[model samples]
Target: MHPRPPCRSTHTFTIAGSRVAYDRWSGPGRPVLLLHALLFDRTQWWPLAADLAASCTVVAPDLPGHGESPMWTGCTPEQVAGVLARLVESLGLRRAPVVVGHATSAPLATAFADHFAVHGVVTVDEPVDLAGSGPAAVVAASGVDRVPERFRSFAEPREDPGLVAAYRSWLDRPSTLRPVPHARHPADDLNPPRFTPLSDPESLASRIQYLL
Candidate 1:
C-alpha cells in the first residue's frame, strides 16, 4: 500500500488583531500545539506533525510575524500568548492541551503555560535558559548554528534577552518543560540547522510520541 496520507488541514483566524494561519493535523489521542523557533514558520513542524497525526491532533501555527500570519509589528510574548490562547479556543481543543516549542519559541511555550490552560510544555533544542535574564544569555546558550537564509538579518534582534526573560518567568514547573536531546548534529544537513523538528524529525517525533 502507498504511504498513508497525513490527516491535515489549514486554517486562519484573527488573534491579537492579526490573521494567523496554521495547520491542524488530526489523529485520535490528546491534542498538541506546535510552535516554531524564531525565523521559522508552522511548516517546520510538518514532518513531525504528520507522523504524530497517526495518533493525535497537532496544531502548528505561524506566530504573528511569520508564514502567512500578518506582520505584527511590536510583537511581544504576552501578545503572542494572547493570540495563541484565542487560537486554542477557536479550534475548540480541550482545556489544557499540551504545547510544544522549538528553539527561541521555547519561551513562547512557557509564555503559553503562563497565561493559558495547558497540560504541559515540551521543548526541542535550546530551551530558554531560565537563569538567564537577557539576550546575551540566550545567545550564549543557543546550540543552534544556522539560520534559513531569509532570516539571517533578523536573527540577532530575535535573540534579545529581554524577549527571552519575558517568557522564561512563566515556565514554572521544571517537569513540564521537556527537552528532546540530540547526540550530535547531522553532519550533511548542517547549515547547521539548529531546530531538530526540521533537521531531525524522526528523532523529535519519537520524543513527542512518548509525550502523547
Candidate 2:
C-alpha cells in the first residue's frame, strides 16, 4: 500500500466579492478543485486531498454560501458553477482541472462540466435527482428545505449532549447555518454508494489521479 502524503499548507483567497476559502496542498500543476456538499466545507476532502496533491496540485474551494465563502444573495447551482468557472480562469489553471463535487454540489459540478471544459469530473454520493430539482422546489413541495421533511422529522430518543448543544447553537445563530429546508424523508436525500462513480477513498484518489 502507498503511504499517505503529507498535508500541504492551507490558504484562502477572495473572488467575486466572496471569500473563496481553499487549502492548497500542492502547487504549479493542474489544480484539482473540490466542491463540497451543502452541509460541509472544503475540509471534507481532508481524507484524500493530500494524497492527490502528491501527484498533482490540489485546490479545494468552499463554494460561496458555504464554509468561509461569503454567502451570496439568491445563490443557485448555475450561478455557483459560473463562479467556479471564473475561479479556474482567474487562477490561470494550466489545464482544465478535474472537479470533484460531493453530495449536493455534484449537480453544480455537472453544470460546470456541461458548460466549461474540464479534464474530468467526479461526483461522489450525490443525490443528483434531488439536486436537479433545486432547493427551492424541494422546500416548497415537501414543506421543508432542500432535503424532504420526512428525512429530518425523526426525534432523537437519546441524543448526544454535545451534538444537541451544537445544533441548538446553530439554530440560535441564523448566520452560522445555511437557511435550507430539512428533508422529510431521509432516503429521499441519501444515495447508495454503489450508484456513484467514486464511493470510497481509494477509488476517488484513482479518479483524481486520472484527471490530473
Quick one: best TM-score, which candidate? 1
Q: By summed lDDT, which 10 consecutive residues of candidate 2 come out lowest? A: 174-183
In terms of lDDT, the best-performing candidate is: 1
lDDT of 2 by residue, 28-89 (tens): 57878777655445655665665576677777777665566766653556666777777777
Worst 10 contiguous positions by lDDT, candidate 1 = 180-189
* Candidate 2 lDDT for residue 54: 63
Clashes of each: 2, 13
Return the TM-score for each candidate structure: 0.67, 0.63
Give each model's whole-structure lDDT.
Answer: 0.63, 0.53
Q: After superposing candidate 1, which stretches have Cα over 4 Å from the reference?
A: 1-6, 127-193
Off by over 4 Å in 2: 1-7, 128-191, 194-199
